[model samples]
Target: MADAPQTMVIVGGGLAGAKAAETLRAEGFTGRVILLAEEREHPYERPPLSKGYLAGNSAREKVFVHDPTWYAANDVELHLGVTVDRIDRQAREVHLADDGVLGWSRLLLATGASPRTLDVPGAELGGIHYLRRLPDADRLRATLRTLGRENGTLLVVGAGWIGLEVAAAARAYGAEVTVVEPMATPLAVALGPELGRFFAQLHQDHGVRFHFGASVTSFEGQDGMVLAAHTDDGEEFPAHAVVVGIGAAPNTGLAAAAGLELATGPGEGGGVAVDGSLRTSDPLIHAAGDVASAEHPLFGRRFRVEHWANALNGGPAAARAMLGQEVVYDRVPYFFSDQYELGMEYSGYAAPGDYARVVLRGDAGRREFIAFWQADDGRVLAAMNVNIWDVTAPLQALIRSRRPVDPDRLADPGVPLTEL
Candidate 1:
């Protein structure tokens, strides 16, 4: 490409931003690259925040995506603890909090998301917390440390991924943990009720309690510290520490302010809607990671994924698009999680209620199984393997093939997925 942009600026110094910067230089782009991170530390992974970090299994330095010297060596100008106020799309500039500005030929909005806050009364109490940044995980680990040293109670609101991971960490640290969710099953929207109940049973076997179909109305405490949770049904639960993980709200303020088009209609999950090339409504602007609601060429619908693999792959795809190269972000979505002794990996794209049946291989009772979800059209929508290894490749292929499958063949351990 001749006369490429002079400068490429990436907003939000998370995994996506870091990868985008890496991809630019790797693609032979010699332009100035500035990666702005709101945090004072180097870009780091977020999954460990609840699993390894909070459980005292990961060291501090292990979380960083790269060493401090990597940025300087790669000529990637790194700015930490900087607040970007707005995107001046008209002038191709980013306004800083202190009224400074940086001109960019291309802009990538990797600005992730924030934890959804509970609207209940006494929400500001000290013992209640949310996990998003490294500091939040650090504080929760400290609380878990105290609980491990003695004994305490932890009330976790919402049964989403983060909530369940935190609950597993807290319980592992010797805390008596209780999780509350308005949904009858945890992750009902994602995994459906059958598998969700399997997870509920897993937690129960590990000594964790659950309050299903319950809503929190307020928190009661003394000394401005959360001590108890009050439910709408007039039930009082002891809560020495409260951690909320309802879900994440995408940070799309700058995109909205810049007049970038967003998703619309029922299937349009909200965010900056982008095409297969990851180009937003504004040609000069690109949105990746959690902030981008990019249309999936495979699913025939837009999907904004917030998993590690998406951020890892989408960043480079967006960078290629920014460089005037032809690229389609058609990679099947993938995600993995660890809870207690169970390690599960899932791949494919399926919105809520897209799958009609789940074909199970191996026994769910033995904690070693693969659940393959199929749509009404007989296509494999998604699949999850617990305590299974090295199977995501074929699982992804099955999804990409989009062919009808025999349930018996799908459930046979002797049958290789490729044959199906």
Candidate 2:
């Protein structure tokens, strides 16, 4: 049995760590709670960094997870702008970059992910930005405005969620956007080529040019500023500014240095490995958010979801588990995105080969529809509602049921989703 919790320390100041701190106090744990944040800013959510905040639709203050005073008000020690150098797991202590030491009975590592950059030439040039933090968004937002005013082109690398969102935001600001992807369609890996083509069409309709089936060979720059991007096909796309949205890699350095067990499999998001309760190999240590690859009870496999919903929910779940409460973290993976006029909520997990086909319930041409990725036997693996609202619960329920449904009725607009 776990010892009575005493001092609890949480590393990483993102939404996961913040929510974990909140949940610890709400659970009536009287132990001292110390939250160590590497970033100088208070805990904040990152979705807006790519969407609203990037578009200037959401204020900077709106991204924070809690008010500045809330940490102190709840007796939770908040250490901002502090870096944890190493974890002395044997001593149950965390050593700070400043040489400070903090003893803890339980520890949580919510060290979120970092934006992955291109390895090609001129990748380090100025005017090339990657969006992952508040400051990144701040810089990109300013660059977009400048590009928009000058009628310049914003070159986007990769056709993933971040790239597409940035493309949409760039267009909204009246700047030209050109997306270069090695894949044939945007979001092909996540949404499949069919829906991926749909997204490609959406952006193409808005004047965003796409160079599909191409990869960036090098970035052309002058005097440390990027000028354009050269593709593998020898095509050159002029770029006043470039945004690299290849992907993000989980910040697992600290945990790995501590000798904690980590997931090594491909596509597992490469994070600290945890069980259903978010407990790592070491009983006294746990990890959540983008840093954790948790064994899900429902899916019967380890999954490290980097979406905002995972961080928002994983932190609290790990906290309850840390408190020795009966806990099972098996939330269906979820994420949302807003690009141009398209708003979408995706629930459940269905990779390319996992699902046999996609079933559509509404008109795809009109861009108001629900798409379901199902198994060969018609079991719902994942569902996405585009320009749809208030159906998350039912969609999640269908995924949880794990039972096959008639594809014909599933594709019928007359059939209620709850019936599935």
lDDT of 2 by residue, 13-58 (tens): 9999999999999999998999999999999999999899999898
Residue pairs with clashing backbones, model 2 = none
Candidate 2 TM-score versus the reference: 0.98
How many pairs of residues collide in each model? Answer: 0, 0
The superposed Cα distance between candidate 1 and the true structure at residue 349, in angstroms, equals: 2.0
Candidate 1 per-residue lDDT, tens place, 79-168, comes to 999999999998999998988799999999999988899998999999999999999999999998887677899999999899899989
TM-score of 1: 0.98
Q: What is the Å distance of residue 124 in model 1 from its true position?
A: 0.6
lDDT of 1 at 12: 89
The TM-scores, one per candidate, come to 0.98, 0.98
Deviation of model 2 at 249, angstroms: 0.7
